[model samples]
Target: ITACYCFGALLLVVASICDLVSSIQLGQDSGAVLSRPANSSRIFYGVMFDAGSTGTRIHVYTFIQKDPEELPVLDNEMFHSIKPGLSAYADMPEMGGYTVRQLLKVAKKTVPRLEWKRTPLVLKATAGLRLLPSEKSQALLEQVQDVFDESPFFVPDDSVSIMNGTNEGILAWVTVNFLTGHLYAETRETVGILDLGGGSTQITFLPKSKKTIGSSPDDYIARIDMFNSTYELYTHRTCIKYLLCHVIHRPPYIIVLLYTPGLEWRVFKSSCLPKKFREEWSFGGLTYIVSGKPDGESYVGYKLCYQEVLKVVKDIVHQPYELKDTSVFYAFSYYFDRAVDAGLIDRTQGGMLEVRDFKKRAKEVCNKMSKYRPINPFLCMDMTYITCLLKDGFGFKENTVLQLTKKVNNVETSWALGATFNHFQNLKIHR
Candidate 1:
């Protein structure tokens, strides 16, 4: 609802959107919304928990109604996260519940007691839980749901669950575009989004070519009613293709999953690692023996790495799409982390770089692995994989500029706010 709370007509979104809710909590005193104090009753709170694979995070959003009939504002946000996500505690479900309860404390301290009952508390799980069997994932969700049930805040229906990957991408797209003020403009020429995660990667944008939209599969289009206008987003299709394609090898997908388990004793070697480097990496309750070629044929580095990752890039079915025509793109998660790890951009003040920048850096990191060593051995592979994904998988032009942002307007670049907005609209909550 960037252009407006544009989804008034979206409540009956689709058959798949049974539990969806709208995020808006407009005041009953809607008579000519004027600037009010921070303490005004119009100011409200939304509590969202991101039950990600690596960790669970809490985002306490403070929203204010500045223009009841126009754009909404996310005035401020209080954020916190802890490592070892709920999935890590899958065996001991109660421990997973403890994590949820701990994060709730942050919400408790942030939202006022008087408004606690009115605030919407939600938790949306990403791919981490999606990897688990349904029974295991359900146990974890049930554990968190127990915590929410006991909390003082208003828990909407199906407040905690494994989020659909399509919804996940859309919500993240909404978070970045909405915060950047792309939604408020008249042109509505919104930027596309690129997220390179372990199990999945998402590419989303408004198609400039009707042929592109028409050629796409039915699942490619997400038809949502926003205000009176309808939007058919093709993110779901792109994401599915990209994720499946990238799995041709382990390096691209495994290293990207910072939260998944790994084989302890396997000396997995890849051309993507610095040729002379070998190290033990541990995370998510497991260890991995990963190393570079160390000493192999000289024909090892970016070229070999690229060819290996290229298999995954081949999975995409394309039309002369508008990804490049969209002008700007936003890449986050591993894209930002690898960029920061490679010294391509600042961790705090994330900067923009062309899609080819990753290619150039990958060449440097891989070709001269013996000369230049990175702190993370996986850097070479990640950089190479990302380069291939953007240039080959998504079919982005070399000159296309990608804005890498970890946070927007001081709030973490998160999809929870969008989900909250979706929930807000879906619930049609009455104060």
Candidate 2:
């Protein structure tokens, strides 16, 4: 019996060595190898997909094994994203389907050679798909599933699953914190996160605690005060229901008649204003008036000053025609008239309001607006939300660490999604 046991142990050791050899050989072919002890449990790779309103993002993470007493190292792993801007679908719903197809195509092309299969892919769709009509949303999901079915042609078999918003927020929070140097002890006392995207923004606040050292905490003391006092107001915007109604030309409309002679103003009127204000004040030709600083640097002081610019633009929708030449005047007037008739702008507000000196008015408005405190601090928290989330939510207790890896900034062009699918398909679960 003792001899038999010894033989069995020898066979097991040989099998382990063979597995390591195979992994090393595979790594050599792939140009990169993540080496670790055979019994290490701290190493893991997480691939996350963020389908935002404006685009889709795929992030790959590699967690390195570490001593229990030392901080764990996080490698960049990889990243990719897609951008069509949800606005493409606002006017035409069919464009959403096209956008998804394009996104899948790009995702398939970017996976690492070795990780083309066996990696787990987590997909989370945010504002864009969430705001789409029920029928459209269902169609979008079906299209995504179909694309996954066909992805094997480009890469190979892999697992893909959708993630809830909460999870996306959590993972994003983790990633951001890891990227930024915020995974330190002092800064971990309390942290706030704000994620701004083309369509909507997500805000999260996490308080500090030491209970999450060894195991996941069952209960976390939420910093509700931080959320209510700082985050809530900063992220408010017109609801989707209101935005959709405006786009479809429903009720509760306001119009603005412009007397200016430039097509540039139309672009501003059409694209700059919030959906609520756009619906409320359908702007006219004078909408593009270049009154306040032709260089676009006039309003810099106001609380959420960009929003003030939007409001100022909306206010000028319907104003008296000023430039010379009746033909020019008619062009401006005709466009303004059409805009109002099309339920784009409102034509009220006493006669044409004109500011003779734009620079002076800009200074005055900026001064007054600057006095209002910004709802959220724009500096430290600008791109720091993701970092805050990881540290607070995922119990990432580590000092600052910099990771270098391949990253795709333009998700729309790169095939990150497909690459992610292929990564998981090739993964070999050793445990």
lDDT of each: 0.69, 0.32
**Which digits, one per residue and each the tens of the lDDT, describe model 1 over residues 169-204?**
787777776667665456876777877766667777
Q: Candidate 1: lDDT of 90?
A: 74
Candidate 2: tens digits of C-alpha lDDT, residues 283-374 = 22222221222333342333333342233233222211211111100011222232223223354311221112222233333443322113
Q: TM-scores across all candidates?
A: 0.82, 0.40
The clash tally of candidate 2 reads: 47
Candidate 2, residue 210: the lDDT equals 37
